[model samples]
Target: MKGQSYSSISFATPSPKQYSETMLHAQQNHATNALRSESKIIPACLPTPNPSSPNFASRFRTDIVQLVETSNIHKHSDTCYKYWNANRGDKKTCRMRMPRKLVSNSTIDPATGDICMRRSDPWINNFNDYLITACRSNMDIKFIWSGSDAKALVYYITDYVTKT
Candidate 1:
């Protein structure tokens, strides 16, 4: 990661043998290290954070917002509690938000006579591209979660993939 101190920290799953070895080594060598301990160490099999090159905080926030938007798109309003309706400004869309008509980077719809989501909006276009990729893909989607079966992947990138 640039503009920061650390390098890339991979979250690739560690084998069971490697895990046990790491645990044993940690116990023998770092028994007194307060910040790090066996308990705080996440298993390599579990998903981990990917800190980035710049301000991870800002990028992380954006990522979270995108994830919520994706969720709202896939799960719809009643299904997800944190669903953020990306098309909130337009009444024609499923979700509605912000009552202001004088928003910047917006245009008045001739039909509705209200400010509507423009075709040039980056947010809408990016989400549309994501939707297309998710829907048209042929491969099985792998979600890092607690269970190994289909039931565990409720919020998967796509609702479902191929063979579980």
Candidate 2:
């Protein structure tokens, strides 16, 4: 029998558009974590002037602010926050944060997947921008342990948002 050609098989890889969209979505979500954490009532609020700490909450807040100011809009879907004071007796954490809203496009349509910015809701932009900025400052905080105990204070930040 003749040798089989490698071209005969097909593998599913995301297209450029899909890849870009995915990266954007991830960046947006991470960026917004800061704002969401701040806005959230749980874990208590931090004191004013916001100390330059590497803590989750501090970094979280800074990230959201950056995303909003930067002119970068990624994939966004309808999402909402629902909190219940009704504590689950078993768990230590009483507060429950759930997504009460649906995940839809900028312009929601049953049959069509067209995103019309002009006709879409206004809150979408403001809220999303907030999120992106928050996420940028909050994700992948495995630094501070990466370097030696030398004099130089090293800080790590992701400038290019790309997928592996």
Query: Which candidate wins on TM-score?
Result: 1
Measured with C-alpha atoms, the lDDT of residue 6 in candidate 2 is: 20
Give the RMSD in angstroms, all C-alphas superposed, for model 2.
22.8
- What lDDT tens digits, residue by residue, belong to model 1 across residues 1-164? 12333212211122244335444544443422232334553222222224653444333323323332333223225533345454675333323331213223435556544433322222222223223223422221222333333444565535566447
Q: Residue-pair clashes per candidate, as listed?
A: 0, 14
Q: How many backbone clashes does candidate 1 have?
A: 0
Per-residue lDDT tens digits for candidate 2, residues 35-62, read 5455763222332223364343433334
State in Å the error of residue 68, model 1. 2.6
Candidate 1: residue pairs that collide: none
Candidate maximizing lDDT: 1
Off by over 4 Å in 2: 1-54, 72-124, 129-164
Model 1 worst lDDT window (10 residues): 6-15
Give residue 45's lDDT in candidate 2 (0 to 100). 36
* Cand. 2 Cα-lDDT: 0.32
After superposing all C-alphas onto the true structure, candidate 1 shows an RMSD in angstroms of 20.0
